[model samples]
Target: MADDSHLRETPLSRTELLRGHFLHVVRDTVRMPDGAQATREFVLHPGAVMVIGLLDDGRVVMERQFRHPMQAVMIEFPAGKLDAGEGSLACAQRELLEETGYSAREWAFAGRLAPTIAYSDEVIDIWFARGLTLGERRLDEGEFLDVFAATPAELQAWCFSGEVIDCKTLIGSMWLQNVQRGEWVLPWAASPGGADAGESGT
Candidate 1:
């Protein structure tokens, strides 16, 4: 692997700008590798998990929720931010059940993604859940969304047609398509006892 220390930036000082329900904003003064100073402002997230749940009949669980920022109902996979001291797998399982009322007997850690790498220190763990069983959904207070199922093909078509534009969902579509084609293999296992994976210190 190539060494990247030469491109690293060291923080000189940091100032908290905003601390909301789940978003923490901060501004920082950093020393560039070239001995120059710069300012960087970004959001600090607790990280999150996005589950691409596969049903036995080849459909995937999906959600349509109104994102305040987008001001539109957006289609996405079952996802949520990690609770305090929560692991990625645990968050995935909780989100899958709470947001969609589905639980999986088998799971595979797909990968991770930083949707806003340039502006936010948020990293979302990608998970694949299969052998699903449906139950009653438990939505959080003040949370409103519609849960449904769509085939991988339908989801991919939306990605191409600019219908499903959520970055995580778009990326999830990529993972689903490749996995369906057998190009990307996932490490499948039975349910885990909740150990964290790929958590970024945001």
Candidate 2:
């Protein structure tokens, strides 16, 4: 393996720029690998999880919600950020239920993704759910979304046509494609052991 210490930077000092209820911004002075000082600004996030839910009819569960930052209605998989001290799998399950009103009998840990590595320390765990059983939704206050299902081909077409622009969702589609083709295999479990979400009626 190649050595990476030559690409490292050491933090000298950090300053808080802003701290919103859910977002934190900070600026840091760091010593670059060449011993030169530089300033870096970024956001601190609590991390998140996204689920790709499989249904009996060969469709995958999805959602449509308006993202304030994008000023657009985005197509996304069910997902949410982790609460304080919450396990990733637990948060995934809670979010899947609260947002979409569905649960899974089997769960799989897909992978992890860092969507905005250049500006934020945010990571989202990718999950796949099956064995769905739907119920009533329990959306969070101020949350508005529509839960739906889409065929893998439909989703891939949308992604290619630029209709679905959410980063997590785009990656989710790629994962689904590979998984469906048997190129990627997930370690599925019946229930949460320490960590993993889905869809049915709602």
Best candidate per TM-score, number? 2
Write the residue-wise lDDT of candidate 1 on 1-202 in tens digits.
9999999999999999999887799999999999999999999999999999998899999999999999999999989999889878878888888888887888899999999999999999999998887877878899999988998889988999999899999999999999999999999988764222111211
- Mind giving the per-residue lDDT tens digits that candidate 2 earns over 61-107? 99999999999999999989988888777777788888877778888
- Would you list the clashing residue pairs of candidate 1? none
- How far out, in Å, is residue 123 in model 1? 0.4
The per-prediction tally of clashing pairs is 0, 1
lDDT of 2 at 107: 84
TM-score, one value per model: 0.93, 0.94
- What is each predicted model's overall lDDT from 0 to 1? 0.88, 0.88
Candidate 2: 10-residue stretch with minimal lDDT: 193-202
| Deviating ranges (above 4 Å) for candidate 1 | 193-202
Stretches > 4 Å off in candidate 2: 193-202
